[model samples]
Target: MEFYSLLFLLLPFAALSGWWMAVRNQRKAHSLIFSRYQKEYLAALKYLVDDQPDKAIQIFTGLVEVDKDTIELHEALGNLFRQRGEVEKAIQIHQNLITKAPLQSGLRSQAIFSLAEDYMRAGLFDRAEALYLELLESGVYKVPSLTALIDIYERERDWTNAINFCQQLERATDKSLKTVEAHYYCELAQEVLNREDPTEAQKYLEQSILCDPNCLRALILSSELSMQMRDYAQAINMMQLVLGRDPSLFPLVKSNLRQCYLMLNTKSAYQSYLQSLLEISFTSPILIEITFELESSEGTESASNYLTDHLRKNPTLAGLSRLIELNTKLVQPAQKNDFQILSELIGSLSKDQPAYKCHNCGFTASYLHWQCPSCKRWNSVTPAVTK
Candidate 1:
């Protein structure tokens, strides 16, 4: 039956019969032994509805006695209060459960974990850490305590501790964390980058790659560090590795690769890379780069032909703008101005378009980020193409 229908049906008889029926049901469920707990529960219910959670918690705690069979009920109530942001009441419930002696191993561990979560909710990280460490010592709630410790260490910017705990978690859980490990190394690499220690940063970047060969953040950092050391060949190799590992980053890293190859005077390799990049799924910026190279080496005719063929398929504002730019280059002096106006219009259209977007939350950004600004997820941002 629908809840509303039951409520309406019971409404007329509620005041007269509900209290008597409730008392009868309580007696039926528990006689002399549970009589005290039943009274406490009803009193707690009254305080709970009256917005006096403190008194409710106290009444509930006194009724638990020695046995821990009520652990589920306490846990349920604690979770409800915590979900309602009543951390104080939740903590009281869990703490009372913990104080009850000879609780089952699992139940005791669960109560302790719940208490730690309550402390975390109350912004008492020290208390939370103490409870979490105690949980670890018991080895009953190892995974949960380790996970909470990881979050705490990350929030506190203690990467070393975070790394150690993450490794411990890996060993305990037998779960692969190579991806997160790679990100941690990248974080260290970035820290050293800001500290003017590219040499140390390079080691962390290398470790990141060794941890996960497909880590794009590591590749980006390695390429940047290679640039600092004037290792253009290695810089180019890193960008190429990124392209193979994560094609979504090609738009972000391609120009840097172009610059690196140009610095090393490797036009043949640049042309080959640009050509491969042009036909990939992420193709617009790659096409633009290739068009520029073609215009420089093979003249405006070849570049215009390439763009014309591609634009017939994709027809982006960027592609059309490049076509106009190439056309104006091939135009006679008199007709050049007309084509130039068309080129200017396409440039204006392309100029104001957003270049990057967070895939997680659709947050637009002008530059790429290793982490999404809105959702805070790693590698969830991609290039937004102009049309």
Candidate 2:
């Protein structure tokens, strides 16, 4: 493009020299042609310099057919089309540029990348993938092309290809791929589990942990797989490991842990654990779970007292309602209805609450998602706890 502009500036001198060569025979016609060309080109250049790309592009497009010198003008018009969301036109222009002879390597690659982007924007993932892979195999535009391929595979849920591309990415930059690799393993493990292949699922989960030991999703899945294999003890161990790593996740594992304890027939063990945990921190759901257990074994009196004691320090509607529900049957009929009403009110209030939230995107979800649906970030969504 710089070559073109430099050549343009020297066109007048070339014309002057040509006029000298032709002598006085065709001077008037040459002068008229030079004047017309110079006037339009200078006007277009002024608009281009002033950032009036619409007018500049229009004037430049009109001039492209006049000479092969307008290749840069075609590029400007293509970029303008892309900026205006006319991706088809942009693709056409860039594709045309690659076909032009004597193309510079930089221009050729730019056109290829731009064409790939246009395909991506047009929802042609296969086309985009092909171009990105071609760029990758060419051993040029490696980083950006691999990045584009990664995004394409991610969007398509082709975790295998995404994993491969990210491996290349880590090789290219030596940036850590620990978290992403872990998520990729998690995705594969989830699919394996859905296909009822526990053996392969276990392998992927182990690989996931090795890739990122801090991945809570891996822990959760590990516990789930252990439970499926009926290793309640190991399941309980995994859930506790998750809690020790991040106690704020207790709410997420608490219900699951309760189920594991039930499966192991270890109620007393869980009761002792829950009592200590509640004293360390308040949990409305654990309080409910514990009160239910207490009422089953020790009767309503102990359960009501236990719930009442916790409610005094860290009260919530759920805790208060559980306490009232436990005591309502033990109460005299006159006061029983009043406690029941309060219990019902608290139940209604808690009904509309969201159970999980994404810390990264402020997206509320009714159930936990290992990867945020809105932001597509792994482990950002967690159980919304009350403590």
Candidate 3:
């Protein structure tokens, strides 16, 4: 009876021991699997760091099947695929995350955004537009979605939609997009002007100025419209406003202003205006225009003297080229050939140099661009004033 009682007491203890052993073995197996997964993850990261994306992508795709909790890892892999220009793979990955994975609401939104970016990279703007529109309802992605939609509209040259979305973006961020909006209005004005509707174009320009009082592009366009209407005085007033706002744009309007002055029969007034401009900013373009005026009105000797004095004050390649050009006419026949050669060489050099440079991105162009082609910033490309 004593032996039987002891065996019965030990039975519960034996069952408890078996349960503990099974739990330990199961934990060991789970730990080994986790350890293998960690090693594979590190190896994939090594492939990415070494710029071997194809191998990294393969490893990551396999890992995703084993672990569905890697939402962040999936995002990283999608970005990597996009950067590698593998848009199809990126789309597939993010789509799978959104549809196949059991993600919460926030993770699902993130997957959708990633897929939208993939579409953008692939230039599937229509598809990307749809996805971005869907994301607009999500608070976390609202601003970015609006911004992306604006970019898409701009690319499509859909100014109406661009302006509408821009207004929404302005309200969302509470920061002024007046300058960008002004540019949008100017774009609309340009389109109407192309369609031979000056009256409609004028309305857009007015709206642009209303948005930003100091919009240089609108003023210039308005002046151009005034010139077309044969209203010289109005054109002159508008151009002067442009100069007062940004004198660097003198190169753009110099010829127009000269023509307006001539139309008004005000040569003396134009000369006076040039002199005043020179007094304020002695740019090469201003000096060159003045020289041409003096040469035509006062004579070559007077123009040569005026240019020589200014050159002494502000030496520039353009000034030097003009001086050489003027001297070529005055030089003896023997020296004329040498002066012409030097002038040609200087002209060749200046031709290769860009006339405008973007302050935002260092992008250079031969002509003025109100918006930078590279960085896409407004009013960034300005006259390149090389010393």
What total of clashing residue pairs does each candidate reach? 0, 0, 0
Which ten contiguous residues of candidate 3 have the minimum total lDDT? 1-10
lDDT-sorted candidate list, best first: 3, 1, 2
lDDT by residue (126-214, candidate 2, tens digit) is 99899888777778889999888888888898999888888999999999888988999998998988887899999999999898989
User: Where does candidate 3 stray beyond 4 Å?
Assistant: 1-68, 101-104, 138-140, 348-353
Candidate 2: residue 185 Cα off by (Å): 0.6
Per-residue lDDT of candidate 3, residues 123-208 (tens digit) = 99999999998888666598999999999998898988989999999999998999999999999998887777889999999999
Candidate number with greatest lDDT: 3
* Prediction 2 global C-alpha lDDT: 0.75
Off by over 4 Å in 2: 1-84, 101-104, 298-302, 317-354, 383-386
Clashing residue pairs in candidate 3, if any? Answer: none
TM-score of each candidate?
A: 0.71, 0.73, 0.81
Off by over 4 Å in 1: 1-37, 50-55, 58-67, 95-108, 122-126, 265-272, 279-282, 291-306, 317-387
- The candidate, 1 or 2, that scores higher on lDDT is 1
Flag the better candidate by lDDT, 2 or 3. 3
